[model samples]
Target: MRDLYSFIIWILSYQIITGQDPPREQYNISCHKVRETCMQDPSKSVPRCIENYMRRCSMIRTRTPVEGYYTRDMSDSRPMLETEEGIIVHISSEALQKSRTKEKMNSNLIVSLVNKTFFVTNSSPEVVYGDNVLGVWLGVKEISNLSEPVQLRFINSNQNENVSCVYWHLDQNGNGYWSTEGCSTNVTNNEFVCSCNHISFFAVLINPKIPEEIHIVRLNYISYVGSALSIVFTATVVIMFLCQRKKHSENSIIIHAQLAGSLFLLHVLFLCSVWFSDRSDQVCTTLGLLLHWCLLATFSWTAIEGFHLYLLLVRVFNIYFKRYMLKISLVAWGVPTVTVMICGIIGKYTSVYGKYAIHEEKEKSSNTSICWITTQTVISYITVNGYLGLVMLFNTVMLAVVLVKMHKLRSQDVQIKLNKKRLWKDWVSLLGLCCVLGVPWSLAFFTRVPLNLPVLYMFTVLNSFQGVFLFLWFLTLTCKARKEEFVPSKGTLNVSFQSTEEHITTNVVSNMIQKK
Candidate 1:
């Protein structure tokens, strides 16, 4: 017992130091003799029995090939043997050495055979000795060798069933490193089967492709352009509200200003922090937290807008609340701050932001390194997207109620006369209001279909231009209302208020009630 323990410890130490797997136990059997028995009870004894038979089979090895040997035609003269198992072509020492060197550098090597390129990736080159000759296991994908009888070379060893193969090609920019754009791979015992539509050089890359890097360039372009435009228009809206503070003091105006402010900050901070996410971890984290707060605040403000609209139309006479803006500010800002703080605490204890890879069999995946919530973990999803989803659902319900109220009001005002131009203006104003007040965001639920790209694009476009829509609506409404006069009563002189559609509705309602 003592000797066995000592030998086991020494073997483990040797394996650790040498960075090699433990030697496999050799078994011998004849597959030809046990073929019928193995076939009959495949699930029970076939795999084990076949593995033993493979262990006993003699490994064939070939000598090193010269430099020009790859392009040579050995179809007629090369020795060929057929067996019930499979065709096995031994590799030469020179080829094995070259493959090993290339594998060490990139782990993705290219071999040109008969004017065709084959990619070598996923599996490493394994050295094997047979009949005093040296060889290596070389997994190659034939890109344009469909018509030719391709030879596969491998080193006889204990094959692992869990090994997977992936297809690889050279990077699009000629960066030397290969990419897995159009290639897919399958594994069978010790061999890799690669498939691709187009004829090109392919390889089995050991490193999986980073999913985030795939479309980052295009995404960055969209974000930069969208954020810049959003900032410009949002700033304009803020300035307009500030300049005309005394003119419009309604709850709706106040809520709109706050929502625009939050959106402005969100866009600005996103632009600044996203580009520098890789440089400083602390800065990225800080910006990420601020961005999260701004996002939540924006949603909160939108919800507030919905609430205000609901009160204005539904409970116009009954609406009464002390310090409305102050209370709303607390809910809008405090909730997000609390949420972000909790997320921050959780992140400190566990990883919530960083590079993550999602593997799904047939779906396009994302691998990203960013200072944002990762969807890879359940906690992150529940805290981030889940929370936002609830907010969106509430806002959507509010939007429906607001729309119904607006429609009813329009129907009640059917006696009012308007030209074609005025009618067009009203339609535009309504559309703009809907966009700025989070109606487009509600459409996000419709983006889960098979053709989601277009819906997502529309959402991004509409949401990014929210500031522009708000600015246009403000300018149009204010300019038109400035030309009209609001006479409150006979004794009171003409009082000019910066009029909005909501104020117009209130004035009409008060007049009707007084007349009654």
Candidate 2:
């Protein structure tokens, strides 16, 4: 036992001293494999498979001219050029000597650059800037974490671009993504430089702007906590609803179940977003589409709730669609699915969904990442924010009309006595109804960039655990329904849905509560 423990401790210490990941191997440039992957149609394969290309890469034809470069002298610098003068890599003499001595390398060094001219990056999280990638290889003895760093100087073509140095990092499946690990960037008016402890494919990527307010950080924490709580509560609601489905299979009950179902899915997808985004590949895109569909479906159901209210309150004489539940379910679920599919197809060419970086004001680099629609894309505005605005408009109008009618009916009625206790209950009912129809979603518009701390906090708190409130509403209405005296009417939904103005004015909330 002592021997086993001692060996485990030794291995752990060795791993920590050498770093968690294995040392970087000398990256060999395979022109044939790269050209084959890059030449394929992007639509025919995973977008990542054809992301980057090698310029001036040529087959070993007897007639073809030389394309790549090689060197042995440690002091000599190399310029990778196809037509215009491209990137210039300056290897420090001290670093090269150190590497050669460490690896016992007597062989020549190889260098090349891959630029954005042929390397498409529309599928990537970060936008590729004008700076090209610098690749270095020494004969197969691998070396990493050099005591001396290698410096790559970049020509600043677009000085206005907010940029950072990144290296191509491959995952377990050999899929490549950009990372800033083991590297640093220095920018000047005319040129920028990337200094890395190890050599790999390096480039500059444009950084996206993110909400910088300190409260935004707090809101993120609130969102995560709220979503987690909602997940637990929503699962409980869903289980309960399913258990009582047969007993309460009315139109209003059906709508409540559907709304609960959508919210449950939306919250779950939102909470697991970061895990999907870490794939830094296709999984992130797929997760983004699913999340967008869930959000839209929730919105669609809220609007349907308003429509149900209109049928019950305004058109009291008759409330029948030939197949009410079926038709509404088709609309609520189908519309969002179609819309998100279209966006996903478009995203295969443009960056519509994937991992998004969040920037902090106090730092020069992105400090956080999440899976979401890219804010820079116009689709985010038209399909998400704009869609929410329309839903909010429709739901707001319906809520207003219901309130007005309730007040008018109450004023004309003489049977019901107004009391403080009754008023408080009415307020609670209205708040619960807001949760059911997602009226608090209007807070999303106010929570946009340049976010107000108070409003943002309120929005997160109210919307995050929406399922808890929804479940309470369900429980309260169920209890109230059971408490009433039993009377089975012979009339159809049309007659039962309607009430004389006198009865409706007795209690607006009682009239609007879901039918069991």
Candidate 3:
């Protein structure tokens, strides 16, 4: 009895040390014989018999299956066990053969490993019609234990040819959480390989990068700073125009004030929406619509400025337009509102704004966002760019015509010939006017070229400071005119007053003499 006990202990120790289980038949026979011996012998302990049975059953449970074949379909219903060796996948030969006969060649295989089950798919696998079945190799490197191998079977669904073999395991959140940051994938022959350094629930992903996530961080910073400055300067311009209302009652000042007010609202709403877009979709959409309206209004006002300038400087004789301000206000505000309403209605049924593909790469793509006109929709192109294009063209034509007229006037006018300094000053003033009126928007034509960065920088800087430039131009003109009117020479002032009084006295005396 002592020798038998020692022998059993030694055998158990040997199995543990080798990490191997005894043969299934041998284990079953030993349990059966032990039960029979305990039954026959009255001295045999009932507890000992039960212990031996449990020990043999455990050995049977841990044993690796001799048959290595598996099919993805069988994994759904089959009982599975997780072991130190890895998750054991077992499929009968008949089941695998039957699965291959199905019409869809592409099918996802579920592989149970440790506490996780992974979905894997093969690139391309041949379908066999008959009983001659070939085993597919599936290699899974368990996140917990890297040494052991887990096998799985897959069918290629042909859903996406560019699907990566690697899958990211995700945690359950309100929305399913998944990422491919650390996962690796490889394919060889009939084998699908997936490996990860850490453990999680994993699955295959197609086109994994979300558009909102692309370049959002960087763009947010640029937009915030630019918009903030624009807001400040635009507000300043509006305030200046309001404070100096009595001094400068020209239509030009009123137009500038309107433009400045519109720009101020645009920048404020843009800054708010860009920063807090994720809080509520409705808010973002509303802001986007408002921005669209303001943007159109701004360009419309710029075009009106050009038209007003054309009448003032070019056709100086017929400078009067009946209710010109009212006409311009209707066109500037009404057009954008109508266009925005139409766009908003159309956008309700379709995607008008969101991420878009700016460029494509072999393995990836670059994407950009247009919050108001999210996508590159036809309506967006026509309404936004088309409208802006027409405005820009009109402004450009007016600018050219004004410049030509100024050149002819400078050559022919007696006043201009007498003062070359005035010619130089007029050129400077014209340049300043062009900057304030968005002539730099023409640089948008060069934005697609290789030198786009510089052009974009110049465009951004000039447009952002447009309010500042307009304000400075107003200040300079006001100061210069005021100085000319009030700051006169002492001698010139005395001579002018004496001449005016003498002429009045002579006219009164001559009238009295004629009456006598």
Residues 1-516, model 2: lDDT tens digits: 999977766775444233232122211334334434433543322212322222223223234433433333343454222223455565555456544645354434555544444333233234566544555654343445765677777778777435677777644333445667787888888777778777666777665223235656777888888888888888787787776676656677678778888998999998778555678567877787788899999999988887887776677557777988999999999999899888888887887887765542232444456677864447877777788888888878877876787676456543333655645655666676688778888887664333344666888899997988888877776554444425432211222221122123324444444222
Kindly indicate the candidate among 2 and 3 with the higher TM-score.
Answer: 2
How far residue 435's Cα lies from its native spot in candidate 2, in Å, is 0.9
lDDT of 1 by residue, 113-179 (tens): 1111112211212111111111111222223323332333323234432222232233322212234
Q: Write the per-residue lDDT of candidate 3 for residues 213-294, one digit (tens) a residue.
A: 4334444456567678778877887887787676656677788788788778777766665555555667667777887888
Kindly report which residue stretches of model 2 are placed more than 4 angstroms away from their true locations once superposed. 1-214, 360-366, 448-451, 485-516
Q: Could you give me the TM-score of model 1 versus the true structure?
A: 0.58
- Model 2 clash pairs are none
Q: How accurate is candidate 2 locally (lDDT)?
A: 0.62
What is the lDDT of every predicted structure here? 0.51, 0.62, 0.50
TM-score of each: 0.58, 0.55, 0.51
